[model samples]
Target: MEPVEINAGAYYLRQLRADRKLDDRPALMEAFADPRHRRYVLNYRLRTPDEATEYVTLRAAQWACDERCSWAVADLATGRLLGEVGLRDLDLDFGTAEASVWTHPAERGKGIAAAGLSAAIQFGFARLGLHEIAYRHDESNTASEVVARRAGFTRVGPEERPSPSGETLIRWVLKPS
Candidate 1:
């Protein structure tokens, strides 16, 4: 898909370009290392800096894939890495994919996730030619649910399955018009 730019209130969304180095690992680690953020997302375990670096590297590789499944959210105003919004488990033939997003703790409640998610959903539907995009979260993650809803994703259904932490999760999906 060609790169897309989406306007969301004060923020704009563009494809995460490879020209930018993923050198924000340390800051990202510190942000995710926070207990509140980690508890809800990473199950409260703070990864070591090295471990965080490895994870970011792996994620960068995923983003670099030709399929356009992942992207980093940048702050157009300050040019900082605000968060990430990504599509995974892509099924091109099926015209469907799964979506996930995260914002740095410092950036939460500033509409970063909502803007980023809106841009990603638009990209999926308009640029990727996807018919549907699914967003799943732990039922307890009210924040994520809010993002999905604000981005125009309906609560289509639910799924009960084990999370990365060995607990059950309730999943949700959204289809494009």
Candidate 2:
């Protein structure tokens, strides 16, 4: 499928193009290193720049032309990497996929994560012809729940699973119509 640039009310959503280098690693590390991001994301610690780069590079390669992958989100006005929104565990035959996202601390509360997630869900359902898209969040993350609701995702159920922090977490899923 061809990558598209989608326009939200305040931001534009585009694929994480190969030509564009990931520039938000430093900021992401800084923000994610904080407890706020770590707690919600179930992260134990922030990764180094090299680790972040490697991870994103791998994801970029996977999402470039695969059925299961995720995309990066950037600020159209400033060209800054605001966050990432992606689909994982995509079952093409079943027409379902899992979604995830993370936004830089400085970019939060401005609707960036919501806008990016809206674009990603649309891409999954419309562009990819997916029957359902599921978004999961840690139960403690009220902020994530807000984003999910704002993006039109409904809570389906809860799941207990191991996280990077080595703790079982409550998970919520949203299946969009």
How does model 1 fare in lDDT?
0.70
What are the per-model C-alpha RMSD values against the true structure? 3.4, 3.1
List model 1 lDDT by residue over 77-111, tens digit each: 75567887877777778899888888888888888
Task: Give lDDT: candidate 1, residue 158.
Answer: 56
Query: What does candidate 2's lDDT look like per residue over 9-83, in tens digits?
Result: 566665543334546567657766866777766533447877666665666666656655565577667666777
**lDDT of each structure?**
0.70, 0.69
User: Local error of candidate 2 at 97, Å?
Assistant: 0.7
lDDT of 2: 0.69
* C-alpha lDDT of residue 156 in model 1: 61
- Clashes in model 1: which pairs? none
Where is model 1 poorest over a 10-residue stretch in terms of lDDT? Answer: 14-23
